[model samples]
Target: MSSILAHNLHLEFDFSYTSFPLVSLSIAFGVWLVWKTWKLITISRASLPLPPGPVPLPIIGNLHQMSVTDQSSTFLQWQEIFGDLVYVNIFGTPTLILNSYEDAKELLGVRSQIYSDRPRLSVAGELVGWNRSLVLGKFGERHRTMRRLLARSIGGKHAQSFRLHEEFAICTFLLNLLEKPRDLKLLLSQLTGSVVLDVAYGHQVKSGHDQLIFWFRRIVQDFYDATAVGSIIVDMIPALTYLHSYIPFTSFKKTVATWRAHLTETIEHPFSRVKEQLRNGIARTSYVAQHLSEGPLDFETEDALKYSSFNLYAGGMETLAVALSTFFFVVTKYPAIQQRAQQEIDNVTEGKRLPTSNDRERLPFVEAVMLEVLRWSPITPTSLPHRLEVEDIYKGYRIPQGAVVYSHPWAMSRDKRSYTSPHEFRPDRFLETPKEPDPRLFAFGFGRRICPGKHIADDTLFLAIALTLATCNVTKRVNEAGDLIEPIPQYTMGVVAHMAEFDFEITSRSDDAIQMLTAAHTQLGE
Candidate 1:
């Protein structure tokens, strides 16, 4: 009875002392919370103050408005509505689309320092473990070092050195194409895969169904499957990462392990063999061997084994291969463009020899055709996502820290503000332009994170496009019912967008084509 009475008395005393103080503190905290929430809401609502777009919902934001999986359609839709500059969001992550050359040059080109950082993809980094991915890595010292190493080894003047092997591979591929015209896909894949493998690892990949070729295809398919949007939902909701694997919702642990296992395996074997060969005094002047000889400095053994090899396989195969695939589509659809390109090639080379990298400057029309091809079918439509590390202003808008910054190459390429007939494939736009904008470099990317293997990709593309035009006419065949049939423009979506696989028939333009190809392959050892 005494204890109960004391407790009641203590409670009465405590209430008398704390009631007013508690109410005051509550009022102060409530006001602070309201102010902070309003500030966040205002900042979140703020954009670069460009064109209008669908307002985003708080938290999830505009992810619902845009296509997260296949952003091309979203980009296209925004272009129609938002004009040159459009803004969207993904879970409160700001995605600014530069829809014109003016916008691309202004934001991605002019203000490059502010625009160069990559968005932090928690899922992509931790789940699939692309933390070391050269293309997807953040803009910083590591990106610079990797890019510098790659540029010295592959891009710029050093890039020209790989053309010998590249041209040789092209000739061999042409011979195989002539022999098996039905398997155009296989021919193109082998042609590109061989060059990338040879240059990156010094492995001589063959024309059809080789081990290296098989593994290359397997790895690319796996990587694509793993990185496809929503492949890892834990990437978006990071708190879920800490959940117990025994729980039904936990999937990241399994997904991450699978991706790491495959990625590590592909990277390690080639590096080990390359290292072994270098130690044996039989040094091949390949990218991996070059790094290996320097002995674990800029590129650690694990990095050499994993990241570098992955970059070559991923960047080299997907971007170049998709571009070529789309080129095939464009050539078949627009024969006039093909004929014009071929005519220029014939006028310059006089039909005497295959087009070489040296002949690039002379064949302006052909170069224009390549440019149009890249523009029409942007391999990486949305050039990798960027992040703002520091809080700054873009065109008088307070762009808060950790906002996602995107460089929309697809949007920019198709913008009516830049190209007159942005919808159509007209190579003459590049040739007849009052000012010939540099299209080749932009197709790669901007600033420090620009593609390292861009030169090799370009040279290979030049050789392939020229030779394919030189050797055969790519045309859509009439169906069994005598109707003109066109291959559907279906795309596989990711950070790198690729055209769906389709077949096309090829026939030699002249008997001279076969002879010229034969002579070239005979002289050029594959």
Candidate 2:
């Protein structure tokens, strides 16, 4: 009986094993069906037309069509072929380029609630610890809080208090030009850095080589270099961040560690000094002082305030430096425009004194020239990237969530529909059509993410241009053969576009101009 039972059990096991193949086949068949369905769904979604763009290769996806150095021009060329909205992928990341003013306004401005978020910059923002910075921070409660604090501290009426700092900085620039004209670029950098320092922390920069200014300048340059599109591979392909430590000399982890250390010093050192001054009862009214007066804040809020206030120097200084450089480049390259601008300044001041922001209303031509400068060479050509928070469609084109949107101010400024002779640097164009939209609309940026320091920047540029033209004759450098060496207004390839180094001669317009600068310097006791 026991032998029979064992035989029966063996037979049952063999029978079950014989049927296993059928069950296996059924399971595999179900998996295949599910995979087929998923693939079809994916294909259907992908068939939705992305805005017209160059045919992309599998993984790179139009990366070959891009130039890391001149991305703005490349985007403009793509726009010519693809239309106002051009979609491309940077290493699997979807990017939307807005080449027209209307498109930019509709998407980045009008739809800001969903489009105001900043893209994650793995290398520049996260690795380098710049995520704390208001400019690079994500869109959230923290960003909103920082923006609100910044608006109260530096936007609109609050910005007016910085006009005196701008005036003083420009006055010093005028005097510096008289003594060391060859250092024009350095002087401009100092002027911008000094004004922002005074306004943000009530810290006066003693000279062009002030220790604080030096660190801030280095930090700004590095930040731009790190954040510029395509500068770091890890930024485009975030997964590569994991491999950063494994790479040899190409390790972004090591590079970012170094940058992070310096950035901490850059953001915290000055802020600590300001706090110390406040503790010692030697504080001056400034962004930091005002915020500190609000009482102690949580670590997160305090960090936000520090970074937000630092933005005055970080964002304002580099941009204004570049703008002032472009102004010099433009005026010197086109002497007739320079002459016209100088004539406007002369008329406004009547050669009696240095032009001030109080005379800004009367100096319409100078204002137009400033507008033209902003249009002709936008500092941040592709204003900072804005990311989408939700899926959206416009004009029958799909803009998926997480798409990085860039407003092409450089392209929009050159749009033929907006300005006649758009390529020409003509201030007269702005004067002719007072109703025409100013480039400042796009130059400073769009929506809630627009520059809060716009007022201070505008006032600083206006006064600097007015004072420089009123007191100095900016012209091309004369060669040994006595020929005028005209400057080619080539710009540096970065977010903050500055004119490449060029030779120029700046001289007092007349003895009266010299006297005016001298008197102003004496009044400031410089």
- Candidate 2, residue 340: the lDDT equals 84
Which candidate tops lDDT? 2
Per-candidate total of colliding backbone pairs: 2, 0
Report the C-alpha displacement of residue 101, candidate 2, in angstroms. 0.9
Q: Write the per-residue lDDT of candidate 1 for residues 62-106, one digit (tens) a residue.
A: 776766677777877877876655677677666667656665666
TM-score of 1: 0.84
lDDT of 1: 0.74
Alpha-carbon runs more than 4 Å astray in model 2: 1-48, 228-231, 236-250
Clashing pairs in 1: 117-387, 123-235
lDDT (0 to 1) per candidate:
0.74, 0.84
